[model samples]
Target: MAPKQDKKVEEEEDAIYEVEEIVDHRRSKTKHNMVEYLIKWKDYAPEFNTWEKEHNVYSKGLINIYWAKQPYTLTQFKKKTHEGESSIPKKRPASSQATKIDRKQLAQEIKSSQISTSPPTGLVWTDIDAIVNVFHSEPNTYFAEVKWPGGKRNTYIPTRIIKKYNPLKLIYYYESQLEFYLPP
Candidate 1:
């Protein structure tokens, strides 16, 4: 009974905003085949437009209409591959590999020392104070400069490593970059 009442309250609190239009669409970088729609709300200004996950926007009619007007199909969008040089400068492979091996060794040492850094079944516990920047080294490979808590100099860590740990930070950085580059 309490659960039902709680659900009802939750439904009541949820605001249903009318989607004015699907302004744009982009395939998600992290999730294959997943697309995000830029939603413009009826009563909101352009600044309020947001990129919503495929499942988050519920209006089937709007989604279908948006796709219908698109010149390319989702399949075509998925296959539009670009092999141009990365905007971000590349790092030396030798240095990058050395840094990665050191981190792995440190994690192993921590585990052997019984420092309770992480549970036995999980990945090693890494403390990332912040992600300073992201760089693309090659096609489908990115690196992030991460700051540590102990005042150590920032280290270049592969984005794949960071993605498994803190995906939101990467998302935020990319989103911010889009805002600057996207045409008004």
Candidate 2:
């Protein structure tokens, strides 16, 4: 029984946890030490402790990370964080900064904004802007955004409408759209 206890202790020793880290290359300059590093964050990575065991290179010096998520050059892994969710997540303001916001109202706003239309009676609008994706250049795959009466939106709309409407004409519209939005 004593021997079994000793073996159990040895097995527990093998289960040691090592924290993983990321050294961001974009924010890093070659140096002996003290590179730009990222602490393991929530929902952005596999369990850092487990990853450390699998990779065998658990040190911050070996791994690279970014303040913002991006494609990893070494492992070709995509590191993604949920900081910028489609709908803003409910965050409790620090108790130190004591202030009250109607949480139910905030949630209601989020629920409406995230959805295309409301549940009771929703007016379905085709994702017109999304369909007209404007790319860098005209290649095999092209893109553009078809402007509706409203602001910059990401929805698909039929191209024929662009030809008929004066404001909706797809001439050098990409260049001019900024004129309306930005000062010369």
Candidate 3:
């Protein structure tokens, strides 16, 4: 009887809990730039859900899934934190910051924009003024928001395509966002 009691205690000490789901995620309050996730245990009730830091959670898939559902991208979130600005700016930035391109020309081009019927020759790298934003749209697929020469509004172009034409722009954009993309 003593041996059986000791065995049970050992089993209890080594037990591992399965994760039911990742409920949510948030930046850690006590740690700088730390991410935490709300976890639901496989066999536990709602009240038993707990918050775990990014490193404590073993499954990277859960973190990716949680982020996929969010409207904005991780790079956008990081930009907001570092710049102390909203993810989407409400007003146009100061002329010193945004006046490199001609706004009136960009507005006219956008208003008169038409889809070409000719066979696609692919993107002309020179026409792209800047790579401004990035996001994950589908499994293994990523997109970059590009600022056209006239610069009234940005458009989405697949990052893979940009890599073929001008990889430097993508590299620079990623550096500015302070994000590193690694597959799990």
Each model's number of backbone clashes?
0, 15, 0
Per lDDT, the best of the predicted structures is: 3
> What would the per-residue lDDT of candidate 3 be over residues 48-140, giving only the tens digit for each residue?
999999888755445654554554555666455434656564534435435333333433343355222121245467567777666564568
lDDT of each model, Cα atoms only?
0.62, 0.35, 0.64
The digit string of per-residue lDDT tens for model 2 on 30-52 reads 43222344345334454442222
Better of 1 and 3 by TM-score: 3
TM-score of each model, paired residue for residue? 0.36, 0.20, 0.39
- lDDT of each residue in 1-184, candidate 1, tens digit only: 9999999899757645677899999888789678899999887999999999988875544665565455445565667642243546243343556556544564444334432222123223255666655655456866665666657555666677667777776776666444122232
lDDT score, candidate 1, position 101: 57
Candidate 2: stretches off by over 4 Å: 1-143, 149-152, 174-184
Q: Any runs in candidate 1 off by more than 4 Å, and if so which? A: 1-13, 81-184
lDDT of candidate 3 vs native? 0.64
Residue 19 CA displacement from its true place in model 1, Å: 0.7
Most TM-score-accurate candidate: 3
